[model samples]
Target: MQFVIDDVQKKNLTGKAVMNMSLGGSASQAVNRAIQALNNAGVVPVVAAGNENQDAGNTSPASAPNAITVGAIDARNDRKASFSNFGQSVDVFAPGVNILSVGITSNTATNTLSGTSMASPHVAGLAAYLMGLEGLNTVKAVTDRILALSDASGATVQQNTAGTTNRIANNGQL
Candidate 1:
C-alpha cells in the first residue's frame, strides 16, 4: 500500500482515486492495517472478493474494513458466478465472466478473463469517473456514491450479514 501511495503521489490530483487490487490472500492483521492506511490517505482500496466460492470474510484485503470488496457475476444473465466468493465481506459485484479486455501480452491484444479480479476494475474505473464528473472529492463520498448507485436487485445471493447483500456495480448512474 505504501508503494502504491508513493507512486500515485507523484501525480497531482485533488479528487479521490481508487486502488484496485485484483489479487488477494488469507486474512491478516498486517494486510488489514496496510489497507486502512491506504484508505486514510484518501484512496478507495478496491479488492477482489476471490474466486474460491467460499466466504470472503476469510480473505485478506477483501475482508479489510477499508476496502471495497468486489465479487463476480455473469452480466448476460445477471447471475452470480459459481466461483465467486460471497458473504458479508463483499461490497459489490460486476461483470466477470467472458469479459473482453486488453491482454497482458500486448497493447492491442484482447482476451477473455473471468474472476473477481476482472470485476474489481469495473468499480474502480467508475469511482474515478464519478469523482471527475460528479465532483466527489473524498474517498468516503465516492464510496458512498458507488454503493448508492449499485444494483442490489441483480443479486440472487445475499450476504451473510444482514443489510449488506452483494450489490452489482452500476456505472451508468453517475
Candidate 2:
C-alpha cells in the first residue's frame, strides 16, 4: 500500500500532507514508507495513536517515530479514555465524541464513539485550517503549531506504579 501511495505521491503536483489514519497490525512498514514519502515530498503524515488500552509502546504506526500520534479524549476532557493507549509516543489528544455523525442507527445524530482513530481526523482538519489561516508552507511548522495550540491543561501523564511497573519492568514476572 505504501509503495502504491508513494508512487502516486511522486506524481502529485499539488503537494499536500499525506495523512494515514489506519492503526494497529504490522503496518509499520507502510507508515515508514508514508513518512519517507511525506519527507521526500516535504509534507506531513499524521497518524492515530490507536484505541488499544495498552501502553503506547504496543500501538503500531502510532508508536512509529516522525508521524504525529493522536489520542482520544472524552467530553469533559479530564483523563485518557479507558480504551485510549497512553505513553510518551502519544503526540497529543483531541475531541473524539460525542460527535455528530452517521451512527449505527442509520440516523445522523449525536453518538459517542471513542478511539484515537476518531481523534486523528480532528487534528488533520485543524492542520488544514491552520495552513489556510496562517499561510503555512512547511509541514514541520504546521505540526509544531498544532502541538503548541493543543490544550495540555487536560492532558494526563501516566506514572509508573510499584507492582504494575515492577511486573512490566521485570519481564512480566510478579
Candidate 3:
C-alpha cells in the first residue's frame, strides 16, 4: 500500500489517482495511517466495507476515515447484501451480488461472484470516469460530484444502517 502511495507521490499524480482497496482485516492504525497518507496526496482511496456483516468500524482500511468506504448491495432489490459490513463507516452501497466480471483464467474468461470487493470497483470506476468526464481533478471535487449525482430515490437501500448513506453509485444517469 505504501509502495502505491509512494509511486503516486513520486510520479506527481496527486489529484488524478484513484485507488481500489478491496481487502481488509482487523483494524490497524498503521494501515489507516497509510490510507490517510494516500488521501493527503489527493488520491481517492475507495475501500471495501468488508464481508463480515458487522459494523465496518472494526475493519482496517475500511475504517480509515479518509477513504470512500463502500458497502455491498443486491442489484435486484437495492438492499444491503447479506454479507456486507455496515454502520457509519460505510459511505455508500453498490451492486455486489452475483456480478458478472472478467476472470484470470484466460483472455476470454468470465465469472460471476459477489462481495464488497466487487462493489468497491464500481464506485472507483465511477470516480475515475467522472474525473475525466466532468473535468473534476481534485479528490474533493470528484467526491462531491459523485454524491451529488447519486440516485438516492430509486437506489436507496432498504434497512440500511442508521448512519450509512442510502445512495448508490450513479454514473450521471438517473
Candidate 4:
C-alpha cells in the first residue's frame, strides 16, 4: 500500500488530505500508512470514526493516536447518528446530511449519503481552509486549532463508553 501511495503521490497531489473510504478490511494499517505519508508530505490526516455503532475504543484508525477521527451528527445536531462509532477516539462530530449539495459531480448537484464516512470531510475542509488563511503550516497546530474551536457540548453522546466520553471535555473548553 505504501508503494502504491508513493506512486500516486509522485504522480499527483501529494500534500492533500486523503480519506480511506473502503470498509470490511483491516483499515488501521492502511490508515497508519496514510498518516505516515501525510506526515512525510506535511499534510493533515482526517479519518472517519467508522459506522459500526460500537464504542470507538475498538475501531481502527479512528482508534489510532494522532489521527483526527470524526463522528457523524444529523441535521438536528442533537445526537450522534445511529451508525456513527463513538468512544474516546472520536475527536469531534460534524454534519453528515442525508443530502448534500456539491458542484463537483455537476454544476448543480445534490447527493444523498449517510455514515461517518460522509461526515469526516467537513472537518477536513475546515482544517484545510484554516490552514490556508492562518498559515498554520504544521499538522499539530492545525489539529489543535480545530479541537480548540469545536463545540464540546455534543461530546457526551450515550454511545460513547462511560469513562471514554468525558475525555473530550477534559481535552479543552468548548
Best by lDDT: 3
lDDT-based ranking, best first? 3, 1, 4, 2
Q: What TM value does model 2 have?
A: 0.71
Model 1 CA deviation exceeding 4 Å by range = 9-15, 151-164
To one decimal, what is the Cα RMSD in angstroms of model 2 from the true structure?
Answer: 8.9
TM-score of each: 0.87, 0.71, 0.93, 0.70
Q: Compose the digit string of candidate 2's lDDT tens values, residues 94-162.
A: 655465545676665556566777777777777767777777757778767766555323334233211
Of the two candidates 2 and 3, the one with more favorable lDDT, higher being better, is 3
The alpha-carbon lDDT assigned to residue 51 of candidate 2 equals 72
Model 3 poorest 10 in a row by lDDT: 146-155
lDDT string for model 1 (58-168, tens) is 989889977889888888876788788888888888888999978888889999989998999998998889988998887789888888877533444333334446577
Question: Residue 44 of candidate 3: its Cα lDDT?
Answer: 91
Per-residue accuracy of model 3 over 40-145 as CA lDDT, tens digit each: 8888999999999999999989999889899999999888898999988888888999999999999999999999999999999999998878878777788787
lDDT of 4 by residue, 7-117 (tens): 556776444444443232244666666666666665577778788787765766777666777877775543677887777778777766483646467878766788787
1 against 3, candidate with superior lDDT:
3
TM-score (C-alpha, index-matched) for candidate 4: 0.70
